[model samples]
Target: MKKLFAMLLTVSLLMVSAGAASTQSSNWAQEAVWTAQEAGLVPETLNTSYDTAITRAEFCSLAASLYRIWEANGQLKDITPSSVSFTDCTDEDVLLCASIGVVNGVGDGRFAPDSPIQRQEAASMLHRLAALRTDYAGSTKNKMPHVFFDGENIRSWARSDVYWAYNSGVMTGTGDNAFDPTGQYTREQSIVTILRLYDASYAALPVPNTEAPYHAVLDYSGAGVSRMHLEDKDGNHLLTDFEDTDGYFYDITVFGDWVGLMWNDNANVALYQPATGKRIDGYIFDGIDEKNGVAWAWAYDDENALVVYADGTTGKKFIPKTVWSEGRAIVWANANTLAAIDKNGNTLWQYKTSFNQDTLVYGLGDRVVIEQDNTNTLLANGKLGTAQTYTIIPNKWSANYIGGDNGYYTLYDQNGKALTGSYANALDEVGQDIYCRWVSDTQYEYFHCAAGGNPTTLFTVTVTNGRPGVLPTDGAGVYALQTSQNTIACFDRFGTIIGTIQTPFTLDSLADITFENGCIRVTRMDIGADTSTQTMLYLPTGEPIA
Candidate 1:
């Protein structure tokens, strides 16, 4: 086996050297092309014609080969496509690229393999590759204040990708402050661009330990503030300085193998596959939500409904706002309609609801809960479940509990055990065992229970504001409550006050508080002046982020 490995390496090296030999390159591209050959990025047959326009097939070959090598380097999964066939092209390289998701067909399962590739098209392909190689997921267009003078020439679909490719320093524009987005991209240009992307991340980022879980943090390093300092589940360091930044503002979350980063200012969202070290950016959404291990980023759709997307990390596209993984065949719905699509986004089912404002649509795993006019209908995603009139917050089928109505609610565990026997005005889960329930309009009670143990009241507090809500914490089992109009109190499972977070302005009628683990955001709206004030802070401690 060792001898065979050596022989393969020697053959690969010889082919790389032969490709590097007599490679006639333009003066500007000579070194980059040679470097690409040395790194074995270009094909062995790509020994000449450096200035010739790269065909769709040739670029796909290059991208596909490069990505295979890139993914095999300490990659944690085997997501590479093996057998892909296009009607118009049988080129193995094109199939390989298609398999890896770098390129696609034109129409009717036909790949226009011989077509001359456009610069922006190359940007789109390489942008997809960058998500796999450079961890350069997310949008910089919103973060950067300027646009290319020829931005109007760029296609709307390629806009975010072009911005990402340009700003990440992987690809550059044509001169004269123009991108020349439609310009032809040459073989040499593709080689150089791939190498630049390769240099950005190849071997630089060690694959994260997949056996454990990780989360993101912002802390001061020796040079400056390290924005994405990821830590493991045990609070141990995992990776630091995850993405290159000019010290901008953003927050990141890890959902299983995926890490989602959202810019607080622009509402721009990016996702990272920590296992593969690839990123998906350019999603401008209000927020990301996860339930029962099914996570999705959401934004407003047309007619002011919710549009949910499967993170490109999953290689899935626009899915309906279904909550569970098995709900893939289910359609998305507003309060009025339910339209179902297959995994391929085909409309296989449709139902229009005549619901009013009081309707509640809840998802539990693959099953669905629909409550309208005090009548609840529970649907099994091919499974069996019971429903009631109460609003159920879906957890595992075991921990699912109904919501409060008329200022009182009940709680139940997954095993059908009643968690709260007493009447509770409101409730929120603070930890796996700890819960904070409102016993009255003004009094808030925090309690805990073992898996099979009884509920133990930890502490009771009468508040001045009594807003009936708990501030969200980084999933580390800490609960934050607005103790007063102007202050927030954070607690652990034991009802211990972690700290009191203060707001920048008065908590007016339209005040809103949102946060990640390391950051707390408070916004107060003044309709009288048509203005709003927002403040950012370190969580639990309430120290200003700046």
Candidate 2:
């Protein structure tokens, strides 16, 4: 009887121990560990300790296995492993990772194989791995914007990699704006990041429909309240349910990969990367404008405009009224003074005008066109020449010529030298050496003129209003026009009527029309005891976007 009782007690203890071990392996990382083990990337005998910090050598081994798998899938055939030597990490897998240029030593011929891998170091390694693929090469140079509060803590060498990793969803922070770059990278985090990298490399990237580069903010009524919406240039809805909870008026603008939400209430602004929906801190601008990838913004509570680069570095210059175009800002200092400033806030050139308040400066690819009252002056390389008085073609600032009234126009080169040409009133400059000419009051023709060649008409269109409401930057020749009936008419550069779309509400009910990157944005006002505004977006093709 005594022996039976002792055996039963021992069996019960064994059962309890087994239960505890099973529970430990059944957590969130259990499937990942199992998958890695099955693929032979991780040892089957390894005990699952998800919370434990990963060592350098251990991570290298895992990375090597992943690279080998990728190579087996025919993605890394050009990548040949080179010979490398490290004092500590002499293991075959660790050496393989180094030879493949995915891992490096900590100097002094040592790999620090047993040392815990820091978060930033892991990010760097992952970035290197991603660079091996052509699809990800463009992202490798992307600088880390001010997305985190502790972004300054990140080492310079690791900034790009860390930024790419975080924004691409390969890694996340430990809550708040802190990235914890110096903290230990745990086994669970490493596995998760590796999986995410794999998905990013193999998944189909999202592509916007339109080739134009612009984003728009629209407002509408839904569920008995006002809501704001965001749309890309392709008319795709990005944010459809954004509410103005504070009841503040706002404006939206895009600067390269960053989007700015400027509000009139206290001059508050919010910046975000539309691609990743990640909020970028440390930038305050009342208004933003961009040319190429360089941007200039009106700083809050200051008279100066801040020039910002893609890397989040800024330079300030005093400019009251500024408009950015073709990598330069044309600033109107005072009534008679206009200066062209580069991205570094250096004045490239200055011009004296004869008008104030009625003066408009437009930057066009190394040329500045100053229009005041009824006169237009073209300034290039410190030389000022008068332009024809006709409405400077509605779009195409870089065109060497200006169209005049009564089927007349004048052509010139960038240096303001007159180019001899017999041309009609150009409605718009569609592309390089291409123009949309007015054939009649209701007709237009597309003409292409090659250098040293006669102009050729490509197509013709018969429409009521060939005049574009918004400029075509994509060179596709498509135009959006507002018709007399408050409807939007879509016409090709050659005057072909593609389609017509009605407004969400009515033009009479709206206050103004704004042309944003081929889309029409309008605001409707409800003037009562308490006034309110609603904005809407319409594609150039006349289709309403959300």
Candidate 3:
């Protein structure tokens, strides 16, 4: 990469110096000088000094050039230059920079353009250049903890921009985590900083649609500050800097083109269009299910009326504690009785349970699995049925199988008849036809049990990670498993390894993973520090999506 930069620099110098006379000898800033000249950022007619301190006018000229490049490349748009009336500097570059809010003059209509530029001031200008791009508009300028030993010396207004430059790898401290904010910046240092800023912005270009099948929303919070970002599958950030003011305890659910943000603390939910970063509407919701495209919550000032939002329509009925199914039904438990309601607020059926104990209801296709205190009961379409008592209520998947924590698994038919063979532990169901069962510490068995037919072992996998979980499918039957080694192994129902991806970080460093719309959103963190650093990645390719 350095060699490429050198070659580009040489070409740029040759093009810009075509009809101009060279004034300075080759120096340490030869490459940077060439780059500035080639991009039309610095005037070739001036006698450039590579070791002298950079002036405000020179820095503004460089900033204006970078901004123009971004605008020409389609990364920025609709930037109207400001008409600033500065007393000292009448240079077009300085006026352009000031107009775009990248630079500000001293008070009383005077811009000390000939004064030496400070490090913190330069950082602020570079940050403004970055903000011109739409993808970074949501980023917040939170105070960074322990980033620099001399952070207190930085000007109050420039602290956030300086921290942003430091964290984004565009700038570095002098030594021992000390940022000399008040020091005069040299011409060489100015060029290097500009190059770094240019590289960071260039890498943020949007990914083409054909290569990225999905986008991700990453939530990062630390040191009492939180933010959210949206990025594409190939790791280019689409939106950034969204502040999570309330907290980080929220759920991100995607339906069609919209992403729903459900905060746990409050009943209000926010629906956002990720493509545009616009909040469609905020609604009070207790729970939401994408399969039925419905949000359930108690109406304002009327806790008895259950407000439901589905298909862009709102309906209300007096129902409490509703459990939504994947199909077009909502089931609720009320006074020892379970009732099934359709989408139009019509009650389809109701069944009274034998035991009046407090029960938890879970929908399994057409069957309802109820955990009434210690007894687990399966009711078919709201019909009263027998209950089985277990130490722990078993987890049900695909409606045909229920796995318990007591080292016993059961597979039942549509009529509730138990099939033969005592499977030990069931991990999860793959698609609609296959169930993954744990055979030993490292081995898992995939059974082809369509409609609870005679179980047939389709394939067995010896995973490196003892614990494996199912990944979201890519519309096809192909699924993936994330192992303890932070590796994702993709396979079909037949257990064929179609592809494998090794994550950039370790499994223990992973904070969370959200699988949505055939894409996996992963959050990795460096937890043991004064300030935690959280990074987000888009997998199977393990690229930085945000």
Q: How accurate locally, in lDDT, is each candidate?
A: 0.59, 0.59, 0.58
Best by TM-score: 3
**Over 4 Å off in model 1, which ranges?**
1-23, 76-83, 133-146, 201-546
**Residues 1-546, model 3: lDDT tens digits:** 556766865665567654452434256557655555555555442335556788998887778777877888898856777678887779998898888998888999999988998899988988888778866652432223223445435655675577677766666777644679899887666766676667665222222224433344557757654444445567666433444533233455544445555553445466555565666445444555444455554443443434355434556565453444332343445666666665556777777766443456655334566676577666665554456664222223344545354777666653445654666765466654556778888788766565546777756766554555654654334455555456665444434444565667775534455554334555566666465655444433233334
Instruction: Flag regions of model 2 displaced more than 4 Å.
Output: 1-250, 262-291, 299-304, 320-322, 332-339, 346-366, 370-375, 386-399, 406-410, 413-426, 450-454, 462-466, 469-546
Write one digit per residue (lDDT tens) for candidate 2, span 232-324.
Answer: 677777644334434223556666666666544434566666566666443454434332346766655554566666444556665545445
TM-score between candidate 1 and the true structure: 0.35
TM-score to native of every candidate shown: 0.35, 0.38, 0.41
lDDT of 2: 0.59
Model 1 is weakest, by summed lDDT over 10 consecutive residues, at 202-211
Q: Residue 140 of model 2: what lDDT?
A: 20
Clashes of each: 7, 2, 3
